[model samples]
Target: MKVIAFGASTSSSSINKALATYTANLIEGADVQVLDIANYNVPMFSEDTEKEIGQAEGAQAFLRDLSEADAFVISFAEHNGHYPAAYKNLFDWATRIDRSVFGEKPAVYLATSPGPGGAQTVLGAAVGSAPYFGGNVKASVSVPSFYENFDLDTGKVKNEEIASQLKEAVSALN
Candidate 1:
């Protein structure tokens, strides 16, 4: 299966990216594409901007990514209890291209943060929005204090419980 995994953050040193990358690797026999939101940079989503440029390169790229994927794995990085600006912008651009970019494709939604809440609010918001945008909603997980649970060098889960949960989420995707 062709799977596309990405962190919603555009930060170069995003722990969310690490988590998504690690999760993508756990799924066997899948062609995984680890995408960085930075690759698709837009001026920012706005009616004024859209009226001027129609759609930017980034918006088109977002649509292309969805069009090519059989399944999606996204680990959202919360910024103040909500989606990151970069990701939200991408979502805006995607909706402009196709109202339902997800196209009811199965996905493993994830979230992570430095605190114990593990970006739960943002994950919940996305989960609620998923069905509206054609997400199959296969599984979900939240990794709290990602730095504590993941080993950067080995790219393995240090917390056994979280690792097991991650495995179960991935298995559900199949």
Candidate 2:
């Protein structure tokens, strides 16, 4: 199986990115592709911009990239308790290119932040939106108080209970 992983954030040092990378690697024997939304550089989506510039090559390429994966691992970063600008732009543009943005791929949705909310607000948004975008969310996990729950150097969950929860989620993917 092939898996594509990404954090829905563009920050240079994002906890979401770290969590997504770790989650992606946990799947056994699956080929994984990690994407940074910042690299795509898709401009903000608007009907006017869409009409003027047409489809961006980068956005089209991202759709192609999504099509290549059988599964997806996304860790969303909450910006003002919602989607980040870059990620929202990319998602909007990609959806316009193809309604089935996820291409019916199985997905593991994750979120993390320094605070205790664990980016739950955005994760909830994804849970509601994923199905409409052709995503089959096989699992969803939240890493709350990321700094306290995850070990930066070890790249693993610091708390055993959270680790067990994650293991269960990973098992559901298979």
Candidate 3:
């Protein structure tokens, strides 16, 4: 299976990206592609912006990536307890192009942050929104206290409890 993974953030050193990549690697023999939101620079969505930009090329590229994937792993980053603006903008644009941007693809929704709450609010938003976009959310996970539990340099979840939970959740993707 071809798995496409992404972190819903524009940060150059995004922990969500690192965590998502790590999780994607767990799926045995799957060809995984990791995407960076910064690579898709769709402008903020407004009716006027859409009218001016005509749905954006970046959004089409994002949709193309999803269309190529058999499954997905998305790690959301919380900004004000909500989805980050960059990802939201791209999703909005891609939805306008096609409501089923995810095309009923099996997906694992994940979230992580430095805080104990992880990025649960945004992950909740993803779980709720995925259905509308035809994304099959097989599992949803929140990795709390990312810094204390994940090591950026090694790209591993350091906490045993969290690691075990991740194994179960990610293993379900197989």
Candidate 4:
């Protein structure tokens, strides 16, 4: 199976990205592609911009990449209890190209932060809205106190409980 994974953030040092990559790799025998949204630098989405530029090359490329995936692993980064602007912008533009942006692909949604909230607010939003955008959610996990639960140097989850939960969640994809 081919899995596409990404953190919905543009931070250079995104812990969410690391988590997404680690989680996606848990799928046995699956080819994982990790994407960086920052690389697809499309202008912010707006009706005016859409009218002026039509579909953006960046959005087109993003969609093309997603079209190849059999499943997805996405870690959302919360900005004021919502998606980060850069990710939302890319998603908005992609939606303009295709409203059903996820293309009915199964997805494992995840979220994490250094604090205990685990970015769950945004993760909940993503899960709640996923179906309308063609996402088939397999499972969702929220890892809180990221530094305490995960080992960045090794790119692994140190907390056994969270690791087990993540393993269980990934298993749903199969």
Candidate 5:
């Protein structure tokens, strides 16, 4: 399977990105591509900007990347209980180019943070709204207290229970 994985964030040292990468790699033998939203270079979405610049190259490239994926693993980084501004902007631009941004591909949604709530609010929103954007959501997982549960040096989940949950979630793609 060609799986696309990315954190819904632009932070260079994003914990959500780490979680997404680790989760996507668990799918045995799958070809995985990890993307960084920061590299897209998409401007904030606005009617005026769209009218002025037409389709953004970054948005188009992002859509093209998504089009190649048979499945997806996305980890959301919540800011104030919702999607990060940068991700939302890229998404907004991509949606304008193609409303069905996810292309009906099976996906596993994840969210994580340094605190106990685990960014569950944004994960819930993503799960609820995915179908509208042509996403076939297979599972959703939230990792709480990211620093405590994940080992940064090894890029692995330290907690056995959470690791098992991540494995089960990825298995849903099959």
Candidate 6:
């Protein structure tokens, strides 16, 4: 099976990114593609832009990636208890190009943060919106107090209980 993984945040040191990458690595015998949304550089979605220029090069490339993936792993990073601006922008543009970007693909939705909430608010919103984009959420996990619960450099879960829970959740996707 093929799996594509990415975090919703653009930050270079994103804990959510680490969590997604770690989860992707856990899947056995699966081809993995890691995406950085910052690399896409999509402009904010607007009907005017779409009518005039059509989809941007970045959006088209991202759409192609989505089309190629058999499964998706997304780790959301909360900003003000909601989705980050950059990720939301890319998602908006992708949906405009194809409202169902996920195309009924199975997805593992994850979230991580330094605080106790662990981006759960954004994760909840994503879970609600995922179906609209053709995503079938197979599993979801929230990694709270990420820095305390995980080792950043090694991508190891420090809390065994949380680790087991996350493993179980990702296993469901497989």
Off by over 4 Å in 6: none
The regions of model 2 sitting more than 4 angstroms off are: none
Looking at model 6, the pairs that clash are none
Give Cα distance to truth, residue 147, candidate 1, Å.
1.2
Position 33, candidate 2: lDDT: 91
Model 2 per-residue lDDT tens digits across residues 100-148: 8997778889998899999999999998988898989988998899999
- List TM-score per model, in order: 0.97, 0.96, 0.96, 0.99, 0.99, 0.96
Output the TM-score of candidate 2.
0.96
Local error of candidate 5 at residue 20 (angstroms): 0.5
Please, what is the whole-model Cα lDDT of each candidate in the order they appear?
A: 0.90, 0.88, 0.89, 0.95, 0.96, 0.88
How many steric clashes between backbone atoms does each model show? 1, 0, 0, 0, 0, 0
Name the candidate, 3 or 5, with the larger lDDT value: 5
Clashing pairs in 3: none
Best by lDDT: 5
Per-residue alpha-carbon lDDT of model 4 for 1-174, expressed as tens digits? Answer: 999999999998999999999999999999999999999989989999999999999999999999999999999999999999999999999998899999999899999988999999999999999998998999999999999999989999999999999999999999
- Model 1's alpha-carbon lDDT is 0.90
- The segments of candidate 1 whose C-alpha lies over 4 angstroms from its true place after superposition are none
Q: Select the stronger candidate by lDDT from 1 and 4.
A: 4
Q: Considering lDDT, where higher is better, how would the candidates rank from best to worst? A: 5, 4, 1, 3, 6, 2
Q: What is the lDDT of residue 63 in candidate 4?
A: 96
Per-residue CA lDDT of model 5 for 45-113, tens digit only, reads 899999999999999999999999999999999999999999999999999999999999999999999
Candidate 3 structure quality by residue, lDDT tens digits, 25-134: 88889999999989987777899988887979999999988899999998999999998888888888999999999898888889999998998888888899888899
